[model samples]
Each structure stands twice: as C-alpha cells, then as structure tokens.
Target chain A: MTDVPPPASESQEIWRRRRGRNRALILVLAALAALFFAISIVKLAQHPDLFTISLDGPNPSAVQKAPAKP
Target chain B: MNTSFAETTVAGGGEQSPPSHSVAFANETELADWIALLKPRVMSLVVFTGLIGVLVAPGAINPVLAFTAVLCIAVGAGACGAINMWYDRDIDALMRRTRNRPIPAGRMPPGPALGFGITLAAASVLLMFIATNAVAAGVLALSIGFYVFVYTMWLKRRTPQNIVIGGAAGAFPAVIGWAAVTGSVAPLPLVLFAIVFFWTPAHFWSLALYANSDYAAAGVPMLPVVAGAKETRRQIMLYALILVPVSLVPWAMGFSGPVYGAAAAVLGAGFLVSTWRVLRDRQDAAGSSLTNDAPARAAFRYSIAYLFILFAALAVDRLVG
Candidate 1:
C-alpha cells in the first residue's frame, strides 16, 4: 500500500513545533525526580528538623468584633 | 475547545478544519502537564494571602478549618489558572516568555485543560462548602467565575483594564479566608483587597514594561503597547504612590498595630525610591528604553516580597499584640 500523506494545517504545524518542548519536559522531570528523592532521603536521615506544616494552632488574640449590619 | 484562543485566520489561502493526528504524546509529561496548568506560583501567593486573612479576621478560626480554607483557596486560584492557561494558549504560543508552558507547548490538549479547570473549580467550591461557611464557598465560586469568564474570556483580549478589574479574582481569597472565620466581610479585608487590586497594575506593568517587546510581538494590547513607556512609567509611579498610604490603612483601621504601619512606611518609601530611580535613567538615549536591568529588577522582585512581608507582618502583629 502507498504511504498516506501527513495532514497539513497551520494548527498541525504548530503542534509539531511543540514536540521538542514535550521531550524537554520529560528530561527535566526525570532529573528532578532523582535529585528530589535523593535530597529527601539525605535530609530525612541527617536532619529530622526539616518539615513541619504549621507550628502553633490558631492565634489566640484575634478579637471578635460585632459584625457590621448589612 | 475553540474557546481556548482568540484565533483569527488572517488572509488564508483556503478554508480548513483541524487535521487529524494519530497520537497526542509519547510520554508521561503530557499527563503530568495538568499539574503545570495549575499555575503553582500563583497558587502559593493565593495560599499566603488567604492565610493572612484567616489570621487577621476578628473571629478566630480553628486551625484545621483554617488549613482547609487555605487549601480551597489555592485550588480555586489554580482552577482559574488552568482556564487562563487554556484560553491564553494561543497568545502563550505566540509569546516567547510563555512558549514553554504545557498548553502552549502542546503536551496537553485544550479540551483536557478546560475540563481540568472546571473540575477543580467545582471541587474547590464543594470542598469549601464542606470545610467552611456557605458564604465563603459562594465567594470562592464567584472568584473562579470572575477569573474564567470575566477576566480570561471577556477582558484580557478586549481591554487594558483587564488586570485592573480582573485582579478582583486574586483579592477574593482574603475575603474567602475572612469569611471562613467570621462569615462576613469587613473593612480590614476590603483594605487588603484594595491593596492587591492596586498592586496588580504596578507589579504586572513593570513586567509588561520589561517584556513589552514580547507583548508587542504577540499582538496583545498591554499598557506599554497602547500607552507607550512614558505613560506606563507614570502610571506605575502613581499606583505606587497610592499604594503607600493605602498599604498603611490597616493601622488606621485598628487591625494593624504600629509595627505594620512602620513596615509599610519603610517599604513604601523603598518602592517609591526605586521606582524613581527606574524612571530617571535609561539604557541609552534611544526611543524609551524599556529595559529593566538592575534597580527596576530589584523593584519588581521586591514588590513580591513587599506584599508577602506586609501580610506576614499583619500576622505577627496580631500574634504579639
């Protein structure tokens, strides 16, 4: 069978240009994962002081003023 | 969706439909693109400001509810961001500064973006209803609608006033956080809203000034495109001037103590001085040097810190006072 012609449109051409960026994203993400887990493991093993979401609970001092009439 | 862009085919040789392609992508990056679509940087700022609102509200909120409120705000901000990325995909493709983003890069299709944004928008609102009061949830939903429909669809391409008005979406998290605790709005939150509202043009215009060429190349009508550099710098100065006193309003209204007021004064003075330095000099004697090299770059970066520090100071003052 004869090879089918590729589709031709401005949108398709633009889409083709984006393929490079997708590959770049993949490479970047792979590098990030290796770096991230390594750092995570090292930090957790060496220093347990790294992570805390929030220290104190709600602030105790915010005075409740009466709501203004709507 | 065709809604992704303000597309106009210019003097086309033939009428056409989108071409069929066999496969969209070859990797997991395409699937993970949805996360980038969330605009993580913007979400962080939304979370910070919303937390400040929870902290400054006259009524104290439980820590768990406050955390939930902040998370919902971030989600709502991210939802709008997804739709923004979707709608601006065409311009994002055209502009070099935006060219690397997921939608512009074509890793994720536009249909998925619209779906993801709307889904998150709905989920955030629902979660808000569960975690906080109905008023807070309603405000969160309205913020999403405003960002998607008003800012992205209607205003962005249509007018330069887009950011000025559309910055309301960013301001709503403060109201959402405040309402989560108190179930209503107040002067303090409104002051916070105005601070962000005014801050938008100044902060973004500095960017537009520096990136005027990218905006011009993309054919987007930013202030620098429409009004020219002289007018843009003048407007930046005016906004910073207005922000100085307005930033100090928290103290005047009694929500902030003297520490916040002092911080605002010093910070405001620094902003104005740096902006003046930017206004006075140029890269050369050519036509309006739009280059933001050192002092201007400092101003732009410090502007972000200025805001976060202001909000954080409010939190600190509350804790100490």
Candidate 2:
C-alpha cells in the first residue's frame, strides 16, 4: 500500500511534540549523569579505601631471591 | 487495544484509541504530558515527608547521599503514579477529575507511559541502593510494588477499604528515608509511618466525599460511593480521631521534643475541628451535602496543610532540641 502524507497542521504539531520530547530526554539524561557523579564522589569520600589498588609489587627483598634460574 | 501506533495516523480532532506497541503515532505527546504522568503534586508531599524522615533520624548522613535518597523516593513515588495512571486510564477516562490525563486524553499512548514508569521505578531502586544502603533500596522497591500491585491493581477497584490498606504504600517513604541514613528501621520511623498511615484515610475520604459523583460515574468504589456519604463522614471522623493520637506518638515516646508535642496537639485539635465540621456539614439524612460539600472541601484542603506543618514542626523540633 502507498503511504499518505499527514496534513500540514498535523505534521507541525507532531514536530513540535517530538522536539519537546527530545529536549526533555536530554535534560533528564544530563540530570541523571550529574546525580550519579555526585553519588560516586560522596561514596568514595565516605570510604576512601573502597577502591584501593596497590601500585607496588610485593617487596622483592621480602621474597627469597630465586636462585639464578635453572 | 491491538492497534499499532506506527500504522495509525492522526485524525484532525478527538480522542484516539491507545496504541498497542508503538509510539510513532501523530499525536506525539509533549513533555508536560509526561510530567503530568509523574503527578508532581503528589511527589511534593512524598519528598517532604521523606526529607523530614532523613532530618529527624538519629544519625548523620552525607548531604549528597541524603539528597539522593530523597530524590529516589520522589522518583519512585512518581513512577508509581505513572503506572497507576496507565492502569487506571479506563476508569480515569470515566472520572471527570482524571479524564484529561495524557493516556485517557489520547495525547500519548499507554505503551510509552508504562515503559517510562517501569524504567523509573527500576532506576530509582538501583540508584537508592547505590547511594544509600540495601535496606533503603529494598523498602523503596517494596513501596513501588505495594503501590503498583497491591493498591492500584488489586485493591483499588475491588474494595471500598482501598485507601485504608493502600495508604501503607505512601507511608513507606518516611521509613525508607530513615533507613537510608540508619540502614535500619527504628521505632521513630515506624511511628512516623503510623502517623501518615492513619492520616491518609481522613485526608482522601474528605476529597472522596465531595467527588462522590465522579467516583460513582467511574464505578470505582470509593468509600462515599460504596457506603453512602453519611458513613464516609463518620469514618473520616474516626480516622481523624485516631490520627491525632497517632501523630503525637513520637513526642509521647520521647523521640521528639516538647515543640513537636505542642505542635502536634494544636494541629491535631485543628484537624479534629475540621473533621467535626465535615461530620456536621449541612446534609440530608443520606449525608449528601446540601451546601455543595464545602466543609468536606475545606477539610480536604486543611488535611494537606496539616501534614505539611506537622512534619515541619517535627523537623524543627529535632533540629532545635
């Protein structure tokens, strides 16, 4: 079946609503991102050791020196 | 119900049938319609009480996390409202007060509204868990489930005691807020829950008394519609009487200071007077108001203000005491 185009007034109304919906979605996403960021900062502050990562390997001296290889 | 939104085009004017699965219909809804689905007015009360719960709880929470907890409560409450609107669209269409909701008015399809609600509900619970504790998140999820399942789907249409039982869903925010900080429920938060629980029937029945016709038209068995206006008025008074003492429980239990006790007493007295006026409003033997249900309307308005002020007093007392 062939498609029929909507009338001008109806098309304009549809565009208006679509634009509004798009804007609202953008605002909501931005707000959620900001909220998540704030929550992360607060949680990290409350428990600084929550994500502790030791950059240094185990003390080489503390480990017995392996004999020069086999 | 089976109409595909993608297949349907918008006609010039009038309400359209809801689409089954798509949202590409001509009457793409505006942002305001989506906001309307959230029921922001109801969210305001939930947020206020939840905030008070946080403030009055006996512990310290980071301000950011506290705000997040309240935000989650508000969003969760709004999610329930959106789902309720979706489920009740049929009855909403019949009721004068709700005929203009987005789904019933045909500005938006039901699919998107339901999706929006479920998405928000899940997100709120997840966010609450992330920002607060497991207990807070669990209570938040329970509140959403109680509202969507127990109240909206089950009890709303089946019984006149719907408000009485369903009010527990609304009472959860205070407990949720307390849990967010303390990570557990306390006697104080439970008392606050009781206060809101008892306060709800009087608050809603006052509105139902005046809007009896709308409920009757919609075939929703609100108390006034099922039990007659006279019985509803007496029930309203009974709840009001119970609510006054319940509201004072925090002070009586030594959880609050004298400021709260005094405010609760004064507010409870005012509430009783308001309900008493409603009980004695000019009505025939059948309890239908001859004077346009003005006293019920007044009582309805007073109930909202009463809760706001009473909670504010509690918060203030906690802070100052």
- Best candidate (score: TM-score): 2
Tens-digit per-residue lDDT, B216-239, candidate 1? 887788887888776777887888
**Model 1 residue B310 lDDT score:** 86
Give the lowest summed-lDDT range of ten residues in model 1 chain B: B3-12
What would the per-residue lDDT of candidate 2 be over residues B1-321, giving only the tens digit for each residue? 212322232122334444322234434667898899999999999999999999999889999999999999999999999999889977887788997787777667677899999999999999999999999999999999999999999999999999999999999999999999999998999999999999999999999999989999989999999999999999999999999999989999899999999999999999999999999999997778998989999999999999999999999999999
**Could you give candidate 1's per-residue lDDT for residues A2-70 as a string of tens digits?**
333444663465466576567776985796466446545544654454443344743334435668999
> In every candidate, what fraction of the native interface contacts is reproduced?
0.00, 0.58
The candidate 1 chain A region of ten consecutive residues with least summed lDDT is A52-61
Which segments of model 2 are wrong by more than 4 Å? A58-70, B1-27
lDDT of 2 by residue, A1-70 (tens): 3355555776677788788889888998998899889988887888766555555965454557778976
Predictions in order: lDDT: 0.76, 0.88
Error of 2 at B97 (Å): 0.3
Stretches of model 1 off by over 4 angstroms after superposition: A1-70, B1-31, B283-287, B290-293
Give the top-scoring candidate (lDDT).
2
